[model samples]
Target: MASDDLFLTPLNALHLELGARMVPFAGYSMPVQYAGLMAEHQHTRTAASLFDVSHMGQLRLSGPDAAAAFESLMPVDVQGLGVNKQRYGLLLNEAGGILDDLMFVNTGEDLFVIVNGACKVNDLAHMQATIGTRCTITPMPDHALLALQGPQAVEVLKRLAPGVESLVFMTGGNFAWGEVPLFVTRSGYTGEDGFEISLHKDQAEAFARALLAEPEVKPAGLGARNSLRLEAGLCLYGNDLDQTTTPVEAAINWAMQKVRRTGGERAGGFPGADFVLAQLDGRLPTERLRVGLIAKERVPVREPAELQNMDGQKVGQVTSGLLSPTLNQPIAMGYVRPEYSIEGTELFAIVRGKPVPMTVTKMPFVPTRYYRG
Candidate 1:
């Protein structure tokens, strides 16, 4: 890809002015960190942190047959989703491979969808080609996305948009901030209580600037975001999950509603149902899937590290691995055989040609702080 093809988010100028270290990720020029990774990470855990997620794709799907049309593409029971409620789902190829993971919201008049920044273009293009006839798909190119994450996120958002206080997790509401229409969702990727707001791109910089005016709201970047999600036991596409992985093995089997799996009235007519259903019949082969690793040392274990058995036999590979700022120790996520996936199961990681001791530990190395109320 050419440098000219790099995408820029609405907050690009603000990020640069703040001395953020810019890096190319997911086809966009984004901040990897500002004011150091450890400081930003700690700030978010203790208070609120502002994140520019404008690069993510936001779309509106509508038509009289929208729900029915969308059901043909995803496994989620869209017809049952209450208005303004958000549901997590995946877009699968004909072979049942995960084309992309996304969230869909029932907005009374239309369905609002958000997809990963890196996969948005392909996701949008594919949707147009497949479901265009049944539903109208429109990309919200003029919008900007922002995440306010941490324990104090609710309080921060409440002061600005009082309506946010009533919005529960996975729910969204429209509000006004000085006449600027804002869509706030009490949802986030940080494993903490927070909200993701979508608004016009022209208003992003001013909105971000106003949010940062708060002492608790500091600008955070991709580096801290990655460590935060990994610590939350969340999967990062292209690493923890991909086309080769299935929902069952990815530890997301819970996502597949039983009604859809049992071939009820809405049975297994979707893609890859034959093999996927067959696996659901009996004990699945214990292949290496998503698992946590507790590194024995302070040094962080990067991705692609070779994981081996007690006898030095190769078992699996590390996908998303990093040192935890909150844990004060190294933590990693990878795939390992069912036998080796047991918590406390000891294994070795070859880092720089040295066998490093590691053990399987329950993921979300730290407890999640999502609001239960």
Candidate 2:
């Protein structure tokens, strides 16, 4: 893609001033690294790091039928979502394949949604074509997003946004930073105690500058963000998840609430409900299942790497992999045959024409520190 064809965030100039190394990501010229990926990753683990995530798609849905209308498209209990609470949801196709994964919050008068940058265009169009008549969908293109993440994130945010300390994980509320109106959610992709703030695009630079001025906060880029999330065992849309993957196969069945499952009041009302519920009930068989793998050696096994058993028979392929900055070891996520998906199952990842020993392990290579208070 041409440089001129890339979109620039409202804080583009600010990132340039901070010496951020820019690269094209999801149609936007974004900061991929600042200072160094390892240093920034460590800083976020101990203190706090601010990420410019303004490229994400933000939308508002309002209408008396909004909850019901949206519920028909996802396998979650949107009608039961209380005001100020957010839920992770999946958009599935008719065949039970995922279209996109998103976070949606009920903001009392309206529903607030945030989708992946790359899939937002198609996501919007799909929703409009399927459910637009029942609810009003308005894209919030003028909004900019920032993520302040780390163990000390709350302490840093509380200093400026008073009362935010009370918001627990998966909860959100409207607040203010002086005169700037802000909507903040106590959630993030890094599996850390953090908040994702949304504000007017014009105020993004100033807000980011203010946050960066804090002693505990530093500017981090996408490079650190990727490593952080990978260590957290979180899924990246195009990499760890895709249209060909189902929620059950992806090991994300937790996102499907009980209210939408087999015996509930509104059970099996969403798209792909029959297939998803069948899989959930064990009535359907999955060809492969996603699992975490720990490389026995220091070598990182990247995606598309073949996985094999002791007999040298191919079982699966790696989806995402990297040397974890936090764990100081190589880790990866991949899909394997049902027999090889069990934790502690031994396997090999073929990297560079060589077999790297690996073991299927429980995920979140690093412990998550989500604040529930």
Predicted structure 1: clash tally: 1
lDDT, candidate 1, 1-373, per-residue tens: 2346888898999999999999998899999999998898899999999999988899999999888777777766787789999888877766566778888889899999999988999999888888898899999999999999998888888887777888888999798788889998888888888999999999999989989987789999999999999999888888887788766667777777777788568767666766666666654463556789998877778798989998999998888888888888888888887778889988898999988888899978989888857
Where model 1 places Cα greater than 4 Å from the true spot, the runs are: 1-3, 283-286
Candidate 2 deviation (Cα RMSD): 1.2
- Cα misplacement distance, residue 86 of candidate 2 (Å): 0.8
Scored against the true structure, residue 105 in model 2 reaches a CA lDDT of 99
Residues 297-331, candidate 2, lDDT per residue (tens digit)? 99999998999999999999999999999888899
Off by over 4 Å in 2: 1-3
Each candidate's TM vs. the true structure?
0.96, 0.98
